[model samples]
Structures are given as structure tokens and as C-alpha cells.
Target: MTASNHPIVGILLLAAGKGTRFTAAGGEGNKLLALYPNSNGDQVPLLAFSLSQAVASGLPVRLVTRPDEMEIIAMAEQFGAAVTLVASSGSGETIAAGVCDSANWAGWLIAPADMGWLRSDDYVQVAAALSSDEAQARMMFDDMPGHPVGFGKGYGAALSQLTGDHGARQLLDDTKLVKLAGHSGVVKDADLPAQ
Candidate 1:
């Protein structure tokens, strides 16, 4: 799991969204800070759960969030993830900044902060694929393409050039992407307060 084995592969957790939907769903706080109980009866904030998984995967991880989310930044740092506070403009801007900051990295495994259910194994698989010489990019999904896409070094410049709200989907369309077997959690995003 060292960068030498997977040179460009780094975990970038995108958490800069405004979470307007969650707010509309009666979430009075940052969606990333919303609490959810685990089976062990430990109450954890939604974002913390995701960050734990990323850290457990043994990859260098960077969390991108808004300036106001110092709580999330501190939490990520506590878990040993490198953190970057990007403007809460859109996914594209946040992602672009992350890619730039990790420019030395050979690839990126991008995940949304809301996908608290993403399995650690799924992340391992994507990173494994990115480590291979043939994989330019890899995507996971249940029945369709979903979040937590892995991009190789070949797409670095393109990813850094991204702007606005558009995500890496366009990069997937333009590159040779390898798809991992579907996992329903791949498409599940915490869009509402109850989710």
C-alpha cells in the first residue's frame, strides 16, 4: 500500500458540497457532522465513518472540505488523513484542487463524503486496479457507474483542468476504464437527513 507500489494512487474524499438537500430534509447541521449509531452502539459522525474506512485501506488519503468545516478537517487530521479546505463551490472545483495538491501522486481514488457505506474492500480493489499498468481508470457501481472512481496518472492533467460542477464522469467517458463488479452501496449517497 505504499506509493511505490501504487505510485499515483491516493484517496481523495470530497466533502465540500453545501448539502442543501440535507438542510431541506431538516438537517440543522453540516451533513458530514450528522451522527449515526454503529452496530457496536458507538455514535459516530457520518464523515468520520467514511474517513476511518479510507485510512484503514492503507492508502495516503486527503480530505477536501469547505473552510467552515474545521470540525471535519480536525477529525480527518485526527485519523491521520492529509486535509485540504477548498471553497464550497462545486464538486469540480473541489476535486480539481485536490488533484492539484496531490499532483505528485500517480492516481486518485475519489470518493464522496456522503458514501458512508462504502466497503473497505471496494476501495482496496479499486486501488489494486489503479496499481496495474493496464488500468487507466476504474469505476464501481451496482447496476450503473457510481462514486469512488479510480483514475490513473494518465488523467492527472485532465482532472486538474476540471471546473464548475462537472465531475470525473467526463474523464471516464474519454478514457479506457475498467469496471469492478457492482456493489449497491456504490450508488448509495446520504442525500437526506434519514439516509
Candidate 2:
């Protein structure tokens, strides 16, 4: 969708986590940089997979990562996403920074950087929910809630106020939560180097 048609909704790609588990699982490489062969037989970085999905959704994208991750920034930029550097201490800080940067957006579709399997249509569904009046917050999941939750402009203030390790969980509890059909990729994360 074009910005003019859905001026309120924006895509926020959260990639600032330290990936401690991944480092432990492997040696020193950032899990996002880990290469995996796709069905096409071409090796692709884990982060690029997620980014490709985001771009396919056709939403304006903003990538959030730590200042030191120039590689991540370059990769995201190559995929045509605007990049923002934020502290990687926790999800709360990274999300808050993303929200602060997207303050002018009417709503946001937040996606975790590691969720490589999230389909483009999944994002489309969440964005569609945000376009509706009843969806204050939309979560994508099957058996349970998962990543890439959508938040309307109404919660921008609360999202911006987030601190510490807290995320949008608190806001979801306070607003009208809409649960969409689950996508298996939503639960997939590069928790380990081998994963």
C-alpha cells in the first residue's frame, strides 16, 4: 500500500537485540549474519530473509539496530529500508526508540528482526486490521500471541513511554486486542546459531 492510502500505518523492524543466545550457540558472529540456504539454493543471511518479507509487504520500513551494527544497517538499506540506531539493552528500549522515531505515523506494524519466516501476507493482514476502527492493537499468532503486533496511533504515546525491558505487552492489555490467524514463521526465531 502507498503511504498516501495508509498514511497512519508504518513498518518497524526491531533488530537491536544483543543475540546472546545466538552468540552462545555459535562463536562470535551475529545471528542475523548467519547464512542459510533458501529453497532457491542460494545462501542468504538470516536478517535478509526477514527484510525481504517486510519489503514484500509493501509498507514503509524502518530498521532499528545498535549503533555498532553497520553491516546490519547496510543490508537493510540495500533492501530499501530506512535505518535507525538504538540501544540494544532490551526490547522495550528498541521499541520505544522506534516509536519515538515513528511518532508521526498513524499506526505501526512492529516486527521482530529474527522472525524470518513471517510471510508478507501476514503483515498485510495486520496492516489491514490497523486500517479498521476496531483494531487498537492487532497480534499475529496461531496457538498464542507472537511477533509483528500492530498498534494504532492511539497508543503512540504509551509506546513512546516504554522503558527498561518492557514492550507493547502492557498496551495490548489496555486496548482492544485483535488476534489474527497464526503463521508458523511468527514463532521461528534465530535463537541459536544452528537454528
Candidates in order, TM-scores: namely 0.90, 0.90
- Looking at model 1, which ten-residue stretch has the lowest summed lDDT? 133-142
1-195 in candidate 1: lDDT tens per residue? 854654557899999999999998888789888888876988789888898888888878999998878899899899999988878578888899899999888688998988888877777788877855335445556457775798878788888888888877677744567778857877877888864
Candidate 1 vs. truth: CA RMSD? 2.3
Clash number for every model?
3, 2
What's model 1's lDDT at 173? 48
Badly placed stretches (over 4 Å) of model 1 are 1-8, 131-139
Give every collision pair in model 2.
8-107, 141-182
